[model samples]
Target: MGTSGDLPDGFGPTIGTLGEDPLVAGVIERYPSAPWLTVGPGDDAAVLDLSGSRAGALIACTDTIVEGQDFRRDWSTARDIGIKVAAQNFADVAAMGGRPHTLLVSLTTPADVPASWAHELADGLAAECSRAGAVVAGGDVSAGTEIVIVGTALGSLATPSAVLRSGARPGDVVAVTPGSGRSAAGWALLRAGLVSSAFEGLLSEHRAPVPPYPAGVEAALAGATAMIDTSDGLVRDALRIATASSAVLGSSVVLDLDPGALAASDDLLRAASALGVDAAAAAEWVLTGGEDHCLLACFPSPAVVPAAFRVIGSVLAGDSGVGVRLGGKPFDGEGGFRHWS
Candidate 1:
């Protein structure tokens, strides 16, 4: 079978770029790593080594998404689970200001589950990796009660010393990249059926965190002194930076909401009114809800904050406490999400 794009001399697709697709080696093959390996997927494990900089410490992160604890059987599909797992782990890497190079996955599922489900899961993983410009190097499969995903990622750093949480100054410009609190509003809507048309995008955001992975790298490249991903909650993340860098964290609203976020908030406000859910309480959820997977950072120069960076608040010198202020006034309420009260 041949087409216009096919080789007229019988050189099929396989015979073209692959050199020898069916070629089998009786002996074990070996190749040494080089400066220009790019990304070799055929190897047992993909290896990416960043050069030109003096940094040389490997930061590894591993996370597990269980069927019940992380993802509900009724809410998310297998592919969704895989994508979430990868996204969450990558978020952690970004929080540390590292470039994710390779990912390893392990899957455990019930024997009765559809085989296509696992294939789709792999597809989802690959899709996210492609979006993140990484690769699915190797993974394992086993039996389990339900869907479970384990991912281990390798990260490259510009320097061994990274933009940690513990290093904010009293007047450092506190900023965030592409902020969104719609996840919390969407969750409430799903529970109360108060979802409105304006907030549907927020519902999708709640389902999957759309973090700017490159933002971390850019922030670090732009000399971000301290940074953390907004996974646990903004307050919790700010606390981590405050503790790690021995700095106090403070925030003030400094965002011009994008259309999606604006619409979502409006819809949620209406829905909350109908359901008796305190719409203003969204401050609590937005400041603390986990899984949003955004970035909170400190900048030395507020004027030169990265292109996508949004000015949130400032890092102050004070007692180790989380506080919030409104309209240039300090209000009495806590910020961020905390697990178990």
Candidate 2:
């Protein structure tokens, strides 16, 4: 699409006129140097010197979010989009019990789009990177039909090594960080057109997730057996750990939840009630809702979990499968966001 037939269709300004360096420069201006980075964003390549950092190994992961697929431009601002991509990327590094130090952002957008969108997006990415104690290293920008944001995070693991999902044992306790379902609840409200002052937090959560970055390292130090980011949903990711740990398919792990805990989120419950969604269905957001990016780890029985981690359930010695149970009964409803129904 375009302003006219001859002109390229874009958001704010055309990419052809400004070219790549200026846009790259805009990004470079926003991100400062981190201690671990030898060379920052402006160079031909970003170099990281972790020799003094004392990391045993390097951890890296890449993730992408596309327009219409992962998010709606109308619903999310450039800053929100930036925070989301950065936070989720950090979540993956954290899942491995590593501390993120740098990020490489790859962006694709239509030529006709405004340059400000790109700048704002960079600002958003930089902001989140700083929050995680990381910096934007370098990345690629290209023209595409839709807005696409991809972020790759680099981190280091200390003495115990990267925590794998397969480490969970049958007797381990399942634990998770705080704040679970606000994003799902917010999504429900957005879909239902129920936006209001009452739903601000939920709505914000959906736009930009805040994962517990330090908890990953904390969990590892505290002896977490297995770890994963519940970006996919609790049941699904739990199943990943269960299968990786070689638990039987029918009854390997049970993600037990407390009734009091479920009821504790007054705003989420209230949002559900306002939308006429029952308690069970609302609770489904907590169990199956994806994108909150919270850490779920398994610790040994009598696990001395870190201060931020809360024990929710336990791995069971039984058949194969992951179960989400509340009050000891199997939870009924859908779990998490799936790309395809």
Best by TM-score: 2
Show how many residue pairs clash in every candidate, following the order shown.
Answer: 7, 20
Give me the runs in candidate 1 sitting further than 4 Å from their true place.
1-57, 193-199, 247-264, 267-276, 320-341
lDDT (C-alpha, whole model) for all candidates:
0.62, 0.81
Clashing pairs in 1: 165-241, 166-244, 166-245, 167-245, 252-313, 288-336, 288-337
Worst 10 residues of 2 by lDDT: 247-256
Per-model TM-score, in order, reads 0.73, 0.89
Tens digits of per-residue lDDT, candidate 1, 251-317, equal: 3222111222212255556656656767565555666566778888888778767887877776555
Candidate 2, which segments miss by more than 4 Å at Cα?
Answer: 1-12, 247-264, 321-333
User: What C-alpha lDDT, on a 0 to 100 scale, does residue 235 get in candidate 1?
Assistant: 57
Candidate 2 whole-model C-alpha lDDT, 0 to 1: 0.81
Q: How would you encode candidate 2's per-residue C-alpha lDDT over 1-341 as one tens digit per residue?
A: 44465564244455656788887887678887867778888777988887884456888999999998788887888889999999999999999999888899999998876777788788889899889988898998988899888999998885457899888876788888877887888888988988798888999989889899999999998889889998888767876776777643334655555555544377877988999978876777877888889999999865489988888777666443335556666653356677866
- Model 2 has a clash total of 20
Error of 1 at 29 (Å): 21
